[model samples]
Target chain A: MSALFEFCLRMGDNTLVLGHRVSEWCGHAPVLEEDIALANTALDLIGQTQMWLGLAADVEGQGRSADDLAFLRDAWDFRNLLLVEQPNGDFGVTMMRQFLFDAWHLGQLETLIDSADDRVSAIAQKAIKEVTYHFDRSSGLVIGLGDGSDESHARMQTALDLLWPFAGEGFEADATDLELAGAGIAPNPAGLRAAFDARVEQVLQRATLSLPESRFAHRGGRTGARHSEHLGHMLATMQVLQRSYPGATW
Target chain B: MTPIAQVWEWLDAVPDPEIPVISVTDLGIVRDVDWEDGTLIVTVTPTYSGCPATSVIAMDIETALRDHGVDRIAIRQQLAPPWTTDWLKPAARDKLKTYGIAPPQPAGGPESCPHCGSANVERISQFGSTPCKAQWRCRDCLEPFDYFKCI
Candidate 1:
């Protein structure tokens, strides 16, 4: 695939997988309100994936539709961030994961709004608005849960600790990102780290939570060379119906 | 007959797919209409970035124009200036209240029950049946309603 196609897939795959992860909580959220809120965010992310992947398919000069690209890809060929593929252990963990990703995503989208590519800029313009609300909702919940009762506070802290290491992967720019960044079609992922850290730290402070100091991290999802074991399981379920009844439609 | 004006009039009859009570023009999604090189072009913006209704709305706009004998039509999507609840017509707000959906309030503004006009209301959820609304309930009337949340 071309570098532009790869870059678009990276964007699309991240949102597609994360959207699926969030959608898993549709009926299982702690409260009815949260269930609705999380589902809405999921729909937004999934909708975004359609636009990105649709663009990617065109860039590749492939006849594949967005649905074909989404449903037919194997886990090993997927390029979503490691953090997005992580299991939703609890509501606290789920919110923490979302908060971290949203913070990074806000910076990414804001910078992308000025991209040299018009379509990318237009998509970013629309996406930043929705992502802003996602960040607000998740960050507010992080603070509330982190500063709440003893049990709630501890759970929130545990969630943060467990998810922190994976947060670094978001800032890792591979060959595709670096090429796009050089061409001004994409932002340098590294340039966004400081802003992401500042936002996360400020929220953690209000939540009475401390940032993890560990320097350990994992990578490789961007290149699609490897993925967490969780991805395979999720994809199995996500693509089962498609695999079973090829060309079926409602 | 003024064909361009008639096109706008036909567009005013196109009801929003989700909220059938208000027309797309009344909701302000229809930003501009003009004739260009023998083609009628209608510009629109989606209410939400990920709203599933955008394509449907675009199709509806075309069908509405075609039904009125307009041959060549071009529907354009513009995203530079984002859509906001502020664009909702004043008359549309009153219609929303009558539809049991509280119109969007100014940020941090007081919210009242649409059913009995009671200020004694509480938010049930930050989301409702549609992405644009939030769920709320009135303590006085004991009725649940959708609040058109501020974007």
Candidate 2:
């Protein structure tokens, strides 16, 4: 498989799975504006997955459409980071995950905008703009919930500790990632670690939430061989339509 | 350019559903407007992530151009090149500012109010009157206006 195509699938799968997770909050956000905001962001992210995976299908020369990649793949067959597949525990957990990932994603997109690869650059130029607002909104919520009142701060702090392990995988480089990073189509995940840390620290400190010292970085969730139990449960809902009726298009 | 191309040249006049003064082409939402195999194909990007108006825009494009008798018109929604206010034709920006909604600030920078020209607009809400826009109030104008939030 071409590294770039595989890379695209990896990226697309992360958004696809997590977007589904976030969409579950459509009618259930604590506030109405946030409900619409998260759902809208989910729509954008899923749309982005379709584009990247469609291109991935073309590159793989497998006649696999975006639907095939998204709906056909089993939990173990997905290549997304473990962090994205982690369960959305509560609003606090959701915002924590979103804030962490959005911060990294925004920075990554900013760097990708000028990628030597034209396709990556084009998508990044567009996606980065969207993620910028996404990051701001998510980070804003993280701060609000983390430092608002005693109850709010305690709940948010607990969410942060729960999610800390998964956050490490985002910064680690695997074999395929290193290869793609060398191609100049993607930035080195290792390089983004500092930027991600700094941004998160700023938000956490403002939220009066101390950073957890736990560094038992979770890894090896990609390569399509294994997944958290969360993936199987999420897929039950996500793939329901495609699994029931194959090739059904609107 | 074929007669279909000629028709496309005419369809270029279709104003954006939101920004009526500017054609969809100038807004960069209309990625491709052309004829293929006796069919007219038009591609558009949603103004933001989930602008419900995209379907309206597609239908509007077809209804507007159907008068020319194009057998089939397809509006392919491509989200790869996400829509940006920067894509707004310069002319459209001027029209937007004149029309009361602030134009998007240039990319790689923070946005400013289209009303009182202040960088001090605060985001009041993420969803505006439409999905593509966010509710931002100009601290200077003390007036709430929509920021053409990107997707």
Candidate 3:
């Protein structure tokens, strides 16, 4: 596969997986407001996935649509970060995951707005606006819950610790990333680390949450070498309708 | 040939699927209208990326034009110059207020309850029933309302 296609998949799959995970909270969130917010966030991410994967299909010249790319692909073919595919353990865990991802996602999109490729830049331009709101909401909730009470604080801290290792994979660059970065089509994921760290540190401090001091990065999800077992189960449910019917449409 | 101006008038009559009080054109989503090689091209932008009404709005536009006997119609989605609440027409804002949905404000939240016209409104949630709205409640009237959130 071409590096551009691979890059687009990485971008698309992250949103698709995370969007699905967030959507799982639609009726189950702790409160009505939270339920609506989570659902809205999920919708924005899924919409972005359509754009990125649509571009990926166009670049591949394979006649595959975005829906086909999303539903037909198995876990092994996905290029999302392990952090996004991780289970939404609890409300706190989900928010922590979202906050971490949004931090990096915001920075990445900001840089992407200046991408050498117009399509990539255009997608970023559109996505950044929605992502800015996502980051605002997620980070605000992180601070609110983390500083609220003893129980909330403890859960937020635990979530941060549990999800931190997976966060590093977002910054790890591979050959596809290198080629895109070299061509000015995209930023090297590694270069986004500093901004990510600064944002995380600032938010965690305000949230009264401690950042886990582990730099032990998880590898493989973005590379498609391996994924967490959670991914397969998630995909099974996500792709079930399409997989069963082959070409179902509303 | 139907004048492009006539096409705009027809589109202006098509109500937004989500906010029926305002037409898609009133929402400023109908970016441009022109004729290209005998095909009527209507360019639109979505209020929010995940807005479920985008496809519906396009269909509504097409159906409205087709009813006017303009068969060669093409609806194109544009992303550049992303849609903002600022694009909402002044008349649309008045209509939204009359419909009990607060129009967007540059202050990032509703300035007053659309129903009570009281400045005692508080945000209930940053999100609402639709992607483009937020839930708010009037402190004086104790009635909850949807506010078109600024992007």
Point to the candidate with the largest TM-score. Answer: 3
Chain A: TM-score in each candidate?
A: 0.98, 0.96, 0.99
lDDT for each candidate structure? 0.88, 0.78, 0.92
Specify the CAPRI tier of model 2.
acceptable
lDDT by residue (A14-83, candidate 3, tens digit) is 9999999999998999999999999999999999999999999999998999999999998999999999
Q: Which 10 successive residues of model 1 chain B have the least lDDT summed?
A: B103-112
**Residue range B1-151, candidate 2, lDDT tens digits:** 2465686676678877876877877778888767677677777776654455677788888888777666587878775666666677788767776776666664522277777788887877866555556777888879888766543
Residue B147, candidate 3: alpha-carbon lDDT:
95
Residue range B23-73, candidate 3, lDDT tens digits = 988999999999999999999997787788999999989888999999898
**Compared with the true structure, what per-residue lDDT tens digits does model 1 show for residues B1-151?**
2376787788889999999999898898888888888888899988876778888999998887788778889998787667878899889988888888898988632278989999999877766788788889999999988998887
lDDT tens digits by residue: candidate 1, A52-163: 8988988988699899999998988798889999988999999999999899889999999999998888878878878988998999999999999999999999999999
Off by over 4 Å in 1: B34-41, B69-76, B108-111, B118-122, B137-143
Report the Cα lDDT for residue A67, model 1.
92
Model 2 lDDT at residue A68 = 90
- lDDT of each residue in A187-237, candidate 2, tens digit only: 888898888889899999999998889878877675776678888888988
